[model samples]
Target: MASVADNLTMALRKQIGAKLNVLLLRFFDQNKSGEILSRVTNDLDKITETLQTGLLKLLVAIGTIVGSLAVMFYYDVLLTIIFLVFMAICIIITRMLAGKNLKYAAFRQETLGTLTGIVEEYYTGRNVIKAYNHEKESMEQVCANTELNRKATQKADFLTNSVNPLIRLITRLSQAVIAVIAGTSMLKGTMSVGVVQAFFQYVNQTAEPLTQASYMINTIQSALASAERTFELLDSEEEIADTKTPVVLNRAKGTISFEHVSFGYDSSKLLMKDISFTVKPGQKIAVVGSTGAGKTTLINLLMRFYEVNSGKILVDGISSVDMTRQGLRQNFGMVLQDTWLFGGTIAENIAYGKPDATREEIVAAAKAAKVDYFIRTMPQGYDTMLDNEGGNLSVGQRQLLTIARVFLCNPPILILDEATSSVDTRTEKEINKAMQELMNGRTSFVIAHRLSTIRDADIILFMENGNIIEQGNHQELLIGNCETGLQA
Candidate 1:
């Protein structure tokens, strides 16, 4: 029974966990990942722990108590009635204490979730802490969260423990009452001594179930609290549903146009308004602007990572909203400023998109990204294993690996967000040459702050605040000759 309940609990956790992950990607804010992880791990564990014993124990206890009651009434009705009064009193006392136990259980679970979030944040940001010499501050913050968790746990345990002793006291008092009543009935000749002794045996047997019920009460409360937390994540709003028959884009020619697009992270404050742009099928469009000029935001909108507020973005000739997100994203290849590499062999990371790519193809892509020579120098070459986050490689090398992935994908459209930002001067030149090859006959959006990187772009968009104020070729913008409303 315990094993079956465990399996059921694990299955529930998995289903809810999957739903939470989808919510994390689609709607939940990124800052809540730690909180979500807590629910998925610690809270789910609590639920499983409670369910492992709580359900079976509860059912067995209830069954035993019911059977015992039937036997007691058959043996002697008056004695049974006297025992019933004591049971009623015990129940009333337990009912009074149940609410307090549940409240503490909930508090403990909430505090644990917060503590988990603190731990996650501290560990992930440990590097930043060391770099900034903020170890004392971070430690203090951790200590504070841990202390809060400790107090909550202590209080919850206290309340849960209090119930068992109170129940045991009630059981003892009921047994004493039964003893006196049984003795009186024996002396009054209304009941035989053997029958009175049999009733006493039944009362003793009934205590086992009552004891089990008291112990499990705490477990049930804790489990419900944890289950509530899990369900909250599961019931969260899902992503905006895709069209029932969304168009599937294939073999795309990336002619992109933004038609008076407007958006904001918060509805109260519009971040980008009346943004409009168009790119030919094979043009290299450079988006250059100061920090907070909405350069990345534009790419986000184009990728449908977040939907536009007021206008439509069209790919080729179809509204992007009409295309399935998977189909739409598959048409474009992205190489971002921050490189991400999972724990795998060098070749596997390179072949992430084209999982079935041949070794020759992986090596060719690595060569094109200018990291093939470095890979060869490693201990195991392309078979070298990378740690989580590719800690074994330099930042520049990691960036190159990501670029190599884009080279392998060779999608119709490309988004390069500071692709060469982490590379040395010589390596940047090499990557630029390789990127030029990759960009050929493909629509490309290059986001960069360095003038030299985008100098040869067919179009340059100069943005300020939330609006694109000036746009033209690099030379035209350099000479301030464009007739746009604002000067470059």
Candidate 2:
């Protein structure tokens, strides 16, 4: 269990992150995050606190109405009942309008999330859009999403705003009816001047709370929509689960096995089923599959990004669950399909995996990854800064930097996902040599589309759908499936 302070910090972060993420993720927010934050935090907090405010207002109104009615009835029952009847009609009208306002608020929030998701995806894939020359079309899609969000917000505001006007109009009409009846009653000597004056005060007091209550009702409804989203995010499951007494693994022998492991993002939709494999220390394993054939998903499962639907995974004779996520991941280094490099020095980036590494060790790791040679030739050498998507370095150089990071970590298990997929042939050759060096004396799992990189792999597994369709060494699979027209 997290400490109260930790939990509070997380809640605050989520609230802040939701807003920052909305802002940072410019494409996803049609209504913007700041406004959303105000709605969820400020507005919702007001709503929750208003229960007391509403009750107090109602109590005061009730007392005033009761006292005034008592006086009116003392003078004449028929006239007092008329005032009560008019008030009843006003209450019914405002209640219906308040309900409509609430419904609109809920609908607006759903529209906001949808708009946010659209913007996020578009901005993240802007390069792809440019490559395809679909920038104009993409803008059209965003505009359409923005328009929908605007209309939804407008609808909510319009309905909420309608409440006050309707309340005022109904209250005024009820007062007019009361005045006409009371005046006539008093003229007939059935009502006193004091009674009429008190009744007027009571009628306004009744209608005031009724009107304010309607506003509070609408406020609570709008706030609920925002609160629900904020709460849902806070209540969401964390990506990593660590036990109190987590098994620590500073170093591992790197023996891993998938024991009849069947897993999926969704239970009913299995990504890999009945799959069994073993990776011994210092062995090279290749996983080959077409897009969506469970290749990356396999890697994801190994990293424990998603839990297996059934069966189990073991590393060093211990169940994966027996170790902390941090513990399991500490023994391995990974380079994802998407290259990730923070804005930092080349040496800093290389030394990230092993923060306390000596300069000599950092240089050695960089040399092994074929990154040191290039860094030394640069104006700042290892201290060169990579900024704005590593604009200073080519894609190949960025890859080498990632490899340097992996080398510095020197984990017993290495997982590379499409590491060489985007590089040119020349860079690929250099990286392949570095990869071979890194793979020595360690267990490695490599996912690559290029057949040549994995040609010498000890074992190759080809997958289709969620199952391994073929399994063997490259030489054997090639000779056997040569006529079947399989592409690496």
Candidate 3:
């Protein structure tokens, strides 16, 4: 039974993980990592515990209770009736306690999830917390959450543990009353001494099973609360399904058009309304705007990470919706402001997008990104193993490594989302030259705050409040600056 339970739990955990992997990005935005983690680990463990022991014990207790009742009824009907009256009272009380137990158990699980989210948030931002000297504040927040969890756990445990003793008390009282009535019958010569003894033995059997059943039922109720949480996660919204027959784009010419595009994270509140833009193949498009001006959102729409609320995004004259997300995304390469690296060798990290890349191809790409010299300085060079998130490397190095990944991919369309923001000025200039060569024929979208980096772009787009307010070549925008007071 234990082995079977383990296998079942393993399958459940795997299903939960697979569901999370396919859930829409909005789900992640709304939930905390630690809360999700708690559901996957702690809640699943509760279910497993119930399956391994509580379920088995409850089944046995039920069987014993039924069998014992049959023998008692056969011995004496009057005494059986007396015993059942007290058992009914016990059942009513246990039922009441079980309901309360489930409620408190759910509350306890919720508080635990909150506490986990708090701890995970603080831990991930520990460096910022310390830099700002907010250690005391962080600790206080954790303690407050912990106290909530403690109180909830106390209430749940009180309800769960109290049920056993309460039911036992009621059963013992029933046993005492039955014993008194049986004694009177024995004295009146209506019952044999041996029959009275046997009835008392049966009473003991039934009473013990009743106590055990009450306790196990409460435990099972608590586990059910956990199962509820796990199922909730498994039932979250997932990404839109792929097309039945998707347009396969092995290679794209990189002509993109946004035809009256309108979108918002929330469908009811449109952020970008009636926005339209077009990019010819091999053209350089620079997107510039203040923070929250929908620059990144535009990129997200183009990549189909979040679908547009209303509009058609066309790539190479075909509606992107007609293409599989993977097929559509395959033609574009993106390097974001934030860099991500895993625990692996430097070469492995660079080859992540194309796992079967040769070492020579990896080295050539690194050199083009101006990170080859730095990689060689490491003790094991490209073979050096990086810790989680590449903690051993400087921020600039990490950014360069990501850039190298994009360089190797060499997609027809490139998105550089403040990709060079982390490097020094000299390195930025060098990367700009390399990027210029990279963009010579491929369509590129450059999102940058620095005006100097995009002065030579083929066309510049200035966005505000999710709309493109101005767009022209660098010189045209400058020439119109006096009229519109536009500043790039």
Candidate 4:
């Protein structure tokens, strides 16, 4: 017959394999999971071992008690009752602790997860602290969270640690009481020598597992808590839904429309209300406003990152709902406000998510975005390692590299979010010339605060508090005191 260990391992593997989203998260989880897996295996293995050991001792205790009872029952009834009462007390003590201890163990495991999240946050941003010389403050933050975790663990362990000595003390005291009662009965010639000897042996066997069990509960509780937290994360709502049959968008002409769209992170407070707009194919639209004017929200809606509260967004009169998120995003290229570069080669970063682009295409995209010049001058050229989120490159260079990524993607609809903010005026003009060429026969949306770039846009929108308050060609918004000089 297969061992219990083999059966448990097989069951665990099957459960883990069944939940795809949970399984994916586990693959990404590099911390604690390995230890947790080992712990479950150990705890379960010991349960089998503990049963074998505990059962044998229990059987021996029963035999001794029976042998003593046969003779002792013939002694005074009071002596038999006295010994039985103390044994009952030990049983009650063990029963009370078993369930309560398990709960504390779960709470301690949750505290550990919070600590891990904080540690992972710091490790992910270590270079940010180093580059800006924020190491002291970052170190202090980590220390504070660590101390908090230490206290939480100590508090949870307090109950577990106390139960063992408390249970053991009660068992010892009860055994002493039983011994006295049996000795007194013997002196009265009410019990035989064999009976007293068997009574002592029975007491040891009965009290041993109870005392051992109190300590065992502590370990079992901790394991239970870990399982609860892991399961909680796994059960959380996934980011996107999988369709039984997904819609396939074969081609895009870049026509986008928003019909009375509204959204908010919280439903009670609406961010954008009934905002409607239409972009014809190949139109260059500039969304201009001060900070917090909901320009980014508009881009988010276009990308389908967050669902609109009401109304509809359509591409070529096709409802965004009909398109899979992947299909919707594949046709639109975006450069975010927060410039992100992966840790890899200059060439590899450019070809991200578009693995089949040719070497000549990658070089051409980099040249168009003006990143090729810097990459060529580097010690290893396009093959240089860019650890630390490409911190070795300047902010402008990183932004250009991101632009090169978009150029390689070459979507029908392009979003440039403060795209020219990083590069110098000279470099801006060069990128602008290239961008103008690239914008041919494609719809584009530019989010900008700088006045210079908007002058060349075919249409301008001045949004305030999510409404299009002012709209025109560049000259129209400029005449309304947003410009430096006289009105048109």
Error of 4 at 320 (Å): 1.7
**lDDT of each model, Cα atoms only?**
0.85, 0.74, 0.91, 0.72
Error of 3 at 363 (Å): 1.0
TM-scores of all models? Answer: 0.94, 0.77, 0.95, 0.75
lDDT tens digits by residue: candidate 1, 89-176: 7777666677777788888888888878888888888899999999999899889988988998998888778878887888888899
Candidate 1: residue 313 Cα off by (Å): 1.5
TM-score of 4: 0.75
Winning candidate number (TM-score): 3
Candidate 4: clashing pairs of residues: 106-225
Residue by residue across 152-181, what tens digits does model 2's lDDT show?
889888887777778778888888988987
Worst ten in a row by lDDT for model 3 = 479-488
Q: Write the per-residue lDDT of candidate 4 for residues 1-488, one digit (tens) a residue.
A: 12543564456445544543333332444445433443344433444444434445545655665665555556445655665676577557655665666665555554555555666676777888799998898888778867876876787667767766887788788778878877887899888778778666655665665565555555455545554554544464444564557677766898888899988756678888887778888888888877888888888888877777899999988888788878888988888767888889889999985889888999999999987988899999988999878989888988899889999988899999888788898888898888887788889999866566677777776677876766678766566665523132
Better of 2 and 3 by lDDT: 3
Model 2, residue 360: what's the lDDT? 96
Q: Distance (Å) between predicted and true CA of 423, model 4?
A: 1.4
Order of all candidates by lDDT, from best down to worst? 3, 1, 2, 4
Scored by lDDT, the top model is 3
**Which regions of candidate 4 fall more than 4 Å away from where they truly are?**
1-145, 180-203, 237-243, 475-488
Looking at model 3, the pairs that clash are none
Alpha carbon lDDT at 329, candidate 3: 90
